[model samples]
Target: MSGQNAKPEATPGVRQFTVAPDDDGIRLDRWFKRHLPQVGFGMVSRWARTGQVRVDGKRVKPEDRLAAGQVLRVPPGGESDRPKPQRRQLSQDEIDRAEAMLIARTDAALVLNKPPGLSTQGGTKTTQHVDGLLDAYAGDDEPRPRLVHRLDKDTSGVLLVARTPGSAAFFSKRFSGRSAKKIYWALVVGVPDLAEGEIDAPLAKQPGTGGEKMHVDEENGQPARTLYRVLDRAGNRAAWVELQPMTGRTHQLRVHLAAIGHPIVGDGKYGGQDAFLTGTISRKMHLHARRLIIDAPKDSRGGGGKLDVTAELPDHFAASLEQLGFDAGMSDARPVAEPPRERTPQEKKQAARQHARQYRKARRGERRTRGAPKPDKPGKR
Candidate 1:
């Protein structure tokens, strides 16, 4: 009932606010959490149920997605009695640390090279994490950056952060749809028998581990796939490999490599004691998310091009590569267009037969060529 660009207007104890572009595509309840933090979800639902909340003059549910330029009508009086959370004040050192991890930044995204040993998000006993440091990147008026994906605490690599709620939804869709490509570099204890192959395994959480650990479960598990290529090998002791996960699963790469008898170096949780090397190699995990390529929000630029970024290896990973006589530059860490599909048994047999037929045909042609008298060299007879 009012201009879309105008600020929240209040009249007769009722308030109307137009959704900002940064809040686009999020649930109505999430919108409250971001802009109206004092309002609890239960209150929002109750208001929605009683037709007190309206969008563009129609009743809307709490889970309904909001679009930019939509006007929201509110009946007010939903502030919770509990004390609101106080935003943590970041120290100068924390600000510096967060800035140091930043590798690339755009209007819609922040690409960070998170180091090993730092958690992506805080946990019960975790006080410091990448999520806590995001406050340093935003100003009072800017939307807080949100994580679209996560990396293990010990696996260092390129981590993507969305600059706004709209971008977060966009990036999350790309990741969930498997359109975003992530390439990782790892050092394993033993070389794989095949130079390149795919691991198709189903994974589920181990029951006794309180959902903290994952294991391969053929009968009841989510499908997981990984494509790996051995770049270089130091005899049978170690090998540097490139890993691309076709499906994002918890510890997929680590568990798959271990299942094939070539456990990733320093991944003791999955590989046990065999994960360590005896020599000068660092004990820290050697897995690094080398590169990420994903579609960017069309509104950020001119509706084309993608965000392609690479992260430098951590100090320990680099040192271990040198100690193992492996060259990090050998592989360019390119993203594959699509995951290779496994061939059926019949298809494999058909391919083998075709190959043998072609070989025999070539041999027969060679024999005929040799048996036939060579053409008399240029009228020699």
Candidate 2:
């Protein structure tokens, strides 16, 4: 019962506690789980329903977010009878593997250079993943690091993890707000016609793929955009490119590139047989997250400055780059200042009106020049 988990002594039957800074922005049920581990979620829900739980004298729901310094009131007697769940212990090898991925560490965050083929979260058949490995980063008294964002299983690169609940909320906001910037390096099947351009296609999950595959669907889709710059081309076979996703759509980069007729090398899910490259190129996906730049939490010991980091390319990708005669150093992997925001209908209409006005003024000037009295024949007059 150290840190913010320690509750103040209270009178009989009822207990009162103040929301702590660490628990701020977390749900009420999460607060109970963190501080009063004996109280189950069902009990918390019942308490809220029966008006036994109150925050600042108002009945609060289990999903209500807690703010720092708020006073909480609770009725007693909701300890669970069942044994508490035990966390799985990691072996030495697992700990080593988790530590190996660490590229940058701070009081608020840990940045890992995730290797390919490792899933960010566990799925139905996925027992081992980056989430499960996070226990290795925490000590017995430390809060477990939580993932703020995700990368595809085959897409290797920098992944951010928040070390505390407050930091988790902080980082999540930056990501959702589009304030964080990420740059990716990829090898595509063919060079694009335009060396540098933006892909403004909308994306939707393909109907038959059970939401696992995405495709361009202008009629019914979410707006998705990606900025791509070709670094170098190895004849017509392959090209090295830098990619910056303007939107966080699932499989956005893969789908957009594939839709434009150039799929990343070895992205069989989107490109099928055409995704593969011949001669010494590994069949693993060639996309890798290269750099991430984001603001640190306010309470971070590192003066709350930006956390900028770059991950080295994975072995297969590096080997492929060398084999293709493409220089990885040719391009600096800097993210664009901002993603291009889509203009509203009113703004578009205004722009069109202004263009029409300019066109009409030019036309009137041309008519006046043609009608002028021919300048009286100059010297002859």
Candidate 3:
């Protein structure tokens, strides 16, 4: 909301940001990952060693905690010069194709109906991607629109792009804080036994799978959750389900659905060939990002309640819906007025005790570290 979208001046040789409220207790190293991810951990350590990275003009260790509203100074060059694959130029055809996908545009954001086959961002062996063509949607004075979130290459629906650096920061905070609401529609092979439920499972990457696949690993996985409601059913064969991932993880929706014995239609990777049907249904993935709602930046338009946007289903998804007798125009079943349950007195007392313990522990650790001797280089020591 600061409207400080202009590029940092060269004279200062640094860029700075005020820590957001949600980041108050996060470590300095994690803060860099949140805001300036391009600056690698190694570079941050080097900067801290050289006294280039500072919080409120005071030198701090990488593990130091950050307070909300404190100013953080970062040297400019690492952000632009960090090692990354050179972005390939987009051909005129690619640019045209990208512009053609634009469904809505605003001063702060752009929404695109991403096609099923297009990758969101480029990578090795990926010559054509949405990131490469974003320039086509930018005006002469606009900064290159930044991808606020990503969808799987085969998943099609509304994709949001931030038009300015301030907007980018604002949306990023919303996402990390779990304040953004995202709805996804998918055709699953079978119906869930219950009308609606939440799946709370932990997920981890499969070893030796090149980090492309995820599996449920209760022992070591990170917590992931999804809320599902069956919207329409076609006998025992297939069902259209609405999924809201409470925690974002790689392939969470796909993995959770499969774990429940109803893998998403055509998600062969997770559900195997059983995920497919013999009829006229397309082999393409049946998942679509249906709707997204988030708070607009405070500095914009009186800081209105929230911005709601819905995306039309892709051609394959729409056709499949029609074939399944599902009404695409149906209203949302989730209630907006669902109030939070009141906590019991015992629960509140336990929560207060837990908070006090953590605060005391963190303070003790900080005191020890503040007076601890700095480690010397291996040879020098």
Measured against the true structure, the TM-scores of the candidates, in listed sequence, are 0.76, 0.76, 0.67
User: Tens digits of per-residue lDDT for model 3 on 309-332?
Assistant: 888888998899898888988746
lDDT per residue for candidate 2 within 1-381, as digits (tens), equals 223533553567787788765566789998888767889999999999989899988999999998877888888789988676566799999999999999988878899999999999999999879999999888777777899999999999999999887788888999998788889999999888889977776678889889999876655777776888888898888889889887899999998787777889999998878799888799999999999989886552225779888898999999999988877776764445465567675754554344335435644765797798856666785
Per-residue lDDT of 222 in model 1? 80
Ranking by lDDT: 1, 2, 3
- Judge candidate 3 at residue 186 and give its lDDT: 95
Stretches of candidate 2 exceeding 4 Å from the true structure: 1-20, 25-30, 40-78, 300-302, 333-337, 344-381
The predictions' CA RMSDs to the true structure, in order, are 13.5, 13.3, 17.8
Each model's lDDT? 0.84, 0.83, 0.77
Q: Model 1: which ten-residue window has the lowest total lDDT?
A: 1-10
Cα-based lDDT at residue 166, candidate 3:
57
